[model samples]
Target: MLDYDREAARYDATRGGDARAEAAAEAVEELLPRQARVVVDVACGTGIVTARLRRPGRRVAGIDRSAGMARMAAARLPGGVVCGDAAARLPLLDGSADAVTMIWLLHLLDQADSAAVLAQAARALRPGGRLLTTVDKNHAAYHTGGDVAALLGPVRDAHTPPQSDALDRVLGVGSGLGLTMSGRTTFAGLGQGRSPRSWREVIPKSPWGRRMDAATLAELGSRLGDLPDQDHPRPDPVYTLIALVKQD
Candidate 1:
């Protein structure tokens, strides 16, 4: 993944800013309990969405591996932001939170790391507590057209996260740890859709692109160059959030 510490500065701007943050928080909330007392958002980059998730009864805290990202989150949430690795053990105690969330996180990891993060999320939740996270992230990048989606085939399947039939496996991972899928929700990616040319520039920085062979990347670039609307944004995707509950 791109250096999150380096990316922290431009994260919100490149992402959909507050408007997108609000939309994401709302979607996550829809999958959360109506009255959760403690909610910890793992990999809460910059705490933008975490801040918006604060509700009357909810006490929100953010944890991230990027010190730079955590600094920004700390400013927004004070001491509520803990600079820590989500793939390893968090400083949190077991069964400490009513809800644990890892939004837009899992797809960024390899299969092993994604499982570790999910394990951590499950460890941080109380029995019967909910764990909400985003999955099928790359799929969102192409809610626009078959052409764009076809070109990004490799990137689209670069994850072990929930999306389409893959969701069954994701739930299986959670179920093995006593976390079962209970519900889900979706939100507009707003301002996140991209055209082929622009997406070509993004390939190298993406998780899949980082590991892609030079020949394949070159071919992808060639294909992208052939597409129309070189600079225009495509249709914004509907991002999905899956909610799982920890069994007692």
Candidate 2:
């Protein structure tokens, strides 16, 4: 995956800012249990959106692997955020939280690591607690309704970065851990459309894109350059949110 520590400085500015965070927070909160007393957001980079998860009578915590990201998170969440590897174990006590979130995390990990994170998330929850995760992050451009979107299909499919089958893999991991798929919803990625250069920059930042051969990148870049709105952004994309519950 991209080096989060290095990217922490500019992370918020490029990530659609507060508008996107609000949309994500709303979707996450809606999926939470009404009685949820404590919630944790895993891989909560920058804690921009994680901060918005806070609600009256509910405590919010953030976890990340990057110290830089955690530093920013601590500013937003105070002493509530921890910098550590969740795949190994979270700093929180077992079954301490009513909800554990891995928003935009699974798609970045491979099968084994993804399973590790899922198990950890499930372990941190009380019986009947929920785990929320977002799948298919990079393919956001594919779902937009605009000319730029129409041109992105070929490029997105060719450079596929963990969008398709992400949910199935998550469900498989959850079920193996005795967690069940509880619910799902969609949220708009507000102000997230990107110009060609912005979208291209995103490629090298992803795990898959970093490994892609130079020839493939060149071909995709050429195809993208031919599309309209080379500098102007396309329509904003939407994200799918899922909720998995650890049964009591």
Candidate 3:
């Protein structure tokens, strides 16, 4: 797994200012009840989503494994942010939160760990509380012809390409974890090689992005650009937002 601790400082500069990050935050916010007061953001890297959740009366706590990321999140969000692993049990009391949200975190885990984290999230939420999560839309792979090559090029420790059905299986892992598929949204960013300047801004902040240098970035741009533009399609690198309700 990529240790976000080393890249915490540059993380926001690389991703926080991007349109995709804003869209993901907006998707999470839409799923929240208008009057919802408390929320937990898991793997809340640098409070990208947590910072956006701040409102007059709402409270948002962000948790991550990287202390540096937590510090960054704390700096941006008024609510407390803590350093902790999502794969293990969460630090909060059982049934303490009104909602729990996970963003771009499911693909990082193997099947077993993914199920464990969802169960833990279910445990932490009060009965009928909401669980909002985002995962990569599997359908995008077929539409984007060069996705596999691009994946091998940049994303290191690449977990299995996420499937659309994975979230339902994850929710079904536990008996009481009844989830309602609230809705799904899609986002497509400039793929590798399409725009070097844009990719440069995004690459250095992520764990994989940190490994790429200017030269490699340029190469990616060239190679990816060489491919036909016809490959790009709506929601080429799409994501699905899942909303689940904890049942007693």
Q: What TM-score, computed on C-alpha atoms, does each candidate reach?
A: 0.87, 0.87, 0.71
Can you write out model 2's per-residue Cα lDDT over 52-142, one digit (the tens) per residue? 9888999999999999999999999999888999889988889999998877787777777888888888888899999998977656657
Q: Which is superior by lDDT, 1 or 3?
A: 1
RMSD of each: 3.0, 2.7, 6.4
Q: In candidate 2, residue 43 scores what lDDT?
A: 93
Candidate 1 Cα outliers beyond 4 Å, as residue runs: 154-166, 204-220
Superposition error at 133 for model 3 (Å): 0.7
Per-residue lDDT for 58 in model 1?
75
Report clash pairs, candidate 3.
Answer: 193-221, 203-209
The C-alpha local distance difference test score for the whole of candidate 2 amounts to: 0.82
- 10 residues in a row with least lDDT, candidate 1: 157-166
Better by TM-score, candidate 3 or 1: 1
Candidate number that wins on lDDT, 1 or 2: 1
- Candidate 2 stretches with Cα past 4 Å from truth are 161-165, 196-223
lDDT of 3 by residue, 1-248 (tens): 56788888787665525565677778877778777788999989888767888778988889988898888888887558888888798988999988998886776677778787887888898877888887644433423445434533434334234442365565566444665555565544323122323433444565554566767656655654554543433223556777777776
